[model samples]
Target chain A: MSNIALEVRDLVKSFSLDGATINAVDQVSFQVRSGEFVALVGPSGSGKTTMLSILAALLTPTSGQVLIDGQDLARMNEKQRVKLRREKIGFTFQSNNLIPFLSARENVEFMLRLNGRLDHASRIRSDELLARLGLSDRLHNLPAQMSGGQQQRVAIARALIHNPAVVLADEPTASLDTERANQVVETFANLIHENGRAGIIVTHDLRMCQYVDRVLQMQDGKLVRTYENKKEIRELARGSIH
Target chain B: MKNFFLASYLAIKEVIRNRGRFLLVALVIALITLLVLFIAALGEGLANGNRQYVANLDAQLIVFLEKSDFSISSSRLETNTVKSVRRVDGVADAGAIYTSSTEIVSLPEPLKVSMLGAEPGRPGMPPVIAGREFRGGEAREAVMDRNVALRTDIEIGDVIQIRSTQGTEDEFFDLEVVGLVEGQSYFFQPTIFVPPATWEIIRPQSQSELTSDTPYPNIIAVKLADPLQTETMSARLVDEISNIEVANIETTINNIPGYSAQQGTVQTQGFFTLLIGILVIGGFFQIQILQKVPQIGVLKAIGSSNGVVGLSAVIQIIVVTMIGVGIGGGLTYLFSLGFPPTIPLVFNGSRSLIAVILLLVIGPLGGMVSIIYAVRIEPLKALRLG
Candidate 1:
């Protein structure tokens, strides 16, 4: 409990469509400790994206408390929340939104640059991270020049470069093939554990769950099940559990 | 300040990466700048050409006939009027000036010229740049303006024939150019100065005025003891001297025929050009921001503030506008070098400076709407994540 990096208490997000209220996220609560990698597995309309957006500080929940490193997000203003997001939280979208004008290394260094931490050591670290992700030769290439899997790996490097307290990714491997997806997820898990950071990845593919320490399954905007045992999680990844 | 630097960095990098696209936009802006500058120069040049002679007069005040309404051509003052003006208090010196239009048949093209009559070494005589001034009563000696010298081959010691209507016949007089004065254009034509006696004999006359010998001058130019007291002296001259209206050089210049209308038209063209520049720049930037909505959304989502995004757009606009204006200024200078003096395209320094400042300011002003649009973009809506 002392090492917990993220805490969500009774988080509920509602939306109005055609004069009817719908709950995108309803009374969801979870915790992830430092050095832990968690996978959020759900169906297409299972509120996974809404939860990720709230964690990224991009959307506000109607009623809830989201605390990162023990600082409640609801207590901060918009400016302060933006600062907190840049300094303490890192996220990658489903499209791996790399700036097209920036090269692969520049894309990764942008995260550090946003936090004003882009120094010589961070530059070296970015290069090392790219090399670890097997993109050593593509460092100077623009996003248009790289394959989808390579771009996804670059996105992962960008997410970790700033050393944020919490890293959230939304379908980061959605564009890659199965083998490329597996390699990217394994390297992501290794980097998160090595850096002692809390990480959450939202994905519909169950096979990617093998690299995560635990799996939380969501349905109809509710947390339905939790698979914490390593063997059971592996069995779920092997497609034995519905 | 830190945010500004970061925004500038991003803007500069994007500009460098997309140099070709930005260069094209800059070229468009440069062309628009050139058009505006050229129109402004034309307006100044035309106005200058019309009033150059009166604008450079040595006298501080011009006395015209009481009902002439400040027009030098319409005013008629007898020799006694000039003498009375000389006797007025604070008057240093006063001279009578006779003006009329004639054609020079010495040139193959028959160039029209404004013939001015002035006493040598008097207030009405312009300073000579080369050679000697015409004698006080010399009938055939004249000082030609430099524009006449530029348009024709008649130099000092060359004889030019002036053709004027006298009574029912056209008479020609042979005059030798003794001196040259620069930039004394009157009514958009090159001017020549002759003595009063010769002007009276050969100046244009209607059929009915063939026998009139009054030798009335068009106006009287008055020099004051203290140039700073021009307004008081002008009032005193009008009050003390009957049958006369007093005016300063500026009022005399403004009363030139078609001067105000020409200036106003050219100014309108330049104004429209600037307005078009704003619209074109605003439209281009608005489209640019719209196309990059997703990229801006991503930046916002990753913790970039609206200030940073809007500032980057502003910096980009200013940089592009500066480059465009610089290129246009260079091109204008180069084009001016190739223009002949007859083109009436003078670039006055202060006026050109003001025009350049306005051109630079329009860049940021034109980009204001686009900056607001970029700042107002919602991150979730832009990324389609909501």
Candidate 2:
């Protein structure tokens, strides 16, 4: 397979409110190659979540196309799109949306179950994934029984356990402390590189950008700047850019 | 099949985690099932009480007076009509019987009884279970129903005094019980079978009709040569005889006074009980779905199809309902054991099965709204991220 895991083409999304059209995502494009972790930084109402939703194939764009693993999202029927979402895409919301009734290991294995590939080997992988995220002792605890940091790590494990082509996380560290957030992001990056899967994280904290391969900044629903150089990315992570 | 198993697994897990809440709802369903089953039992008991005697009549056709409007109590045919009915084609045997309700003097407080007089070994007489049948030329002799013997101290060879309200003054007759027949109650009273001639003398008669001396029967029981030809034989009898109406055994039983209305009331109550069950189950599941909105959203976000979610809900309903129904059936059986035989409660296997099946079906029917609600829960809004 080619290394280019995701390709976007002038993606635009608009919402009509009270007889006015607002461009939530303007004509913008980016590509994510395999084994690369990218961070999307934006202010409130900058359309980061909307762009992430489109990339995950949870929402259809008004124009342009999102191609994941060489398959166009818009061209597939609802059934095919649902199958693609289950098989090729993994995502986590800001709240660490874990199934409250399922234990930590069950929650991670749930992704494999959705893809109809859950087996003895996959069960072992789920346990290994959680253990790598520093949740080895809390595998059998429910989401309600775990701390916020622990739950977020379990969510990360769930996202990667199914081995999807693209993994998306929206503010996954919002509920964790500064130190734990750093550990989670660093572990997330290592997992992405090890598995050779493309990963994208949307967050407001530039300090988290140090773990990512590149940083894409958005302003007014447009990709205004990019920090690809190691020097620039490190400066942004140090809070040195006012 | 995999989806079904997964759905069931999820449903069972939730129920086990929240067992107290589910148990409360299940208890309510059990009580409703108990009440409905009791109502059905009462309906069967009351029907059996009213129609038991006529239903067991060996004759296929019951000939009534044309002017009585199909009412067995008011139909009166003279003795000559019996001879004419026996001569009709396709008639195997015809029997004359007279019936009256009167008080027994042997009991302290006016024990009412339905007195039926028929020729021994005829189609109208009930089979004797305990003692001997009537011999030839037996007079002032009677056979008491088995329930009467069991309920009272009366036995074979006991002389019973009956007080008749016929004529200007009351007449007393000493009749000896010679036999006992089982399940022969009529009109909610234990019946006593006597000779036709003796019954005519003791039957209530107005002063004007007392001196006529014409033997009259309330109805005629006609046995057809081929019982399957009930319709054609009945039509032929009505054509050959004048001033007579004919009905089959089922029609005759249905025409009993208050029988139809009693059964109708119980059936209506049973139907309303089922409706209430549906409403209760639907309301509970709707509340459950509303409370589990976020959980449902998470499942959907992880790629659970609507079919999976809906099937899980249905499985939950079915499991809960079966548990409740099983408990109710057991409780009903236990409760029925303590009731005395005099009470009119009866539990039949087939009718109870029908009621249980109806309850089981209603559980899913009631949960349909909740299933739709679960499947329609949008993940974006439920997670509050939209």
Candidate 3:
């Protein structure tokens, strides 16, 4: 309980679409301890994006609370929320959307620069992360110069460069093939387990669900079930790993 | 911060990538700058011409007649009126000047000249190139400008015809062209200078009775004790005279009505033209922001703050603006050389500097506006994109 990295209580989010109120995320609850790798698995429009947005503090939940290390997220203003996202959370997106202007190394180093923590001290860490991502030779290549998997790997490196407490990856494997996807998932799992830094990956691919410690299923913007699986592609809604 | 640098780097990268659009914007800026420069050059030439003319004269002010529009003929200042102005507060000295515009028939081309009759000590009419100055009270002796002397070759003893404005009575007198004065104005006309007594002989007071004009309008010279009081004295004279209109400083410089107003309009139009430049240039950056919205979202999701994003946008704007204005101002200065002498296009660094600063400020302001649109973008939307 004291090691819990994230705790969410009954969260709700609604949007008016064509004058009809649709609940994008409704009464979602979950908890993950430090070092845990959690997977939020669901089909498209299942509120995974909305949940991820709320977790990142980019969007405020309509109801309930989000507690990261027991610090309630509901009380923070926009400034504090931005600060919280800067200092504690890290994100890796689906498309490996790297800034085209910078080289591979600068792209990864960006996470440190934003928090006003970029300096000589961050250089070694950025280099190390790039190397660990198997991009040491291509560290100077821009996003336009690299392949899909390589860019995604660099993005992951960017997310982890700041040593954030929690890493939020939204469909990190969507743009990659199976081999690349597996490799990315394994890399993420290895980093989370090694650093004890909690990570939550949102994916619809059931094949990759076995890599995470727990998988939460969402329907109609609510959590419907949880599965714990160590085996890849176990029966959905039937497997659980402790 | 890491986020700001990252954001700015991305913004700049987007702009540099679209080299064609950026170049187009710069070219348009240069064109608009050229128009303003053209007008400025014309203004500059006019000012220079006036200054050269005034410096040659050593006269502080030009006194022209103030008259009612009711009469068909142009009214002239009386001989007594010249003395009365000489008695006015700021007057240090005075001279009687007689002027009439007439065409001389002897040359290959009929030259129109302003025939001046004075006592020969006026500030501007000096140094007779071929003859002496208008000597004291000589009714028959006259001096011509250099170009006039060259055209007719009328020496010290030749006679010339003074065409009367009344259309029938032309005075053909042995007007001895005693001297020739050097000036560009001489090239256009045969300017003859005679004493007031000579003007009295040539066009007598008998002509004044036929028309509303005074026969001998005094050719006045107003020597101000203090040059600074010139404005005050001019204003007082204008107010005292029910018909005179005082031309302002800028008007005197450009010799145009409301010169300051015209300058102000040109400056303002230039400002807005540069504003259009900003929009076109800044529009590139604004697009830079929107295109990077997804990237910004990713950064936000990755723990990058909003301030970091905003800072990056502003930095990108600063970079582009400085470069754009540098190129723009440089081109403005470079091409202004070919402008005609009739224009006044002064390259004022301070004014251009202010324009550049305003242009530079527009860049950041442009970025900031885009930043508002950027940081508010949902990090989650980045997740949703294909």
* Best model per lDDT: 1
Off by over 4 Å in 3: A17-21, A229-242, B1-24, B46-62, B68-76, B79-83, B92-223, B226-286, B303-308, B339-386
lDDT of 3: 0.67
Where is model 1 more than 4 Å wrong at Cα?
B337-340
- Kindly list the per-residue Cα lDDT of model 1 for residues A23-141, writing each as its tens digit: 98989999999999999999988998899888888899999999999999888899988898888887777883888788999999988878888899999999999999999999999
List residue ranges in candidate 2 displaced over 4 A.
B102-113, B128-146, B153-182, B201-215
lDDT of 3 by residue, B268-313 (tens): 6766766676566557667867777767777666666666666666
Between the candidate structures 1 and 3, which one is better when assessed by DockQ?
1
lDDT of 2 by residue, A116-152 (tens): 7899999988998898898999998988899888888
lDDT of 3 by residue, A118-237 (tens): 889799888887888798999888788898999988888877888777888888888899999999889988888888888999998777776788888898898987876454335542
lDDT of 2 at B340: 90
Question: For model 1 chain B, where is the 10-residue window of minimal lDDT?
Answer: B346-355
TM-score of each: 0.95, 0.90, 0.74
Check candidate 2 and list the clashing pairs.
none
The window of 10 residues in a row where model 2 chain A has the poorest summed lDDT is A78-87
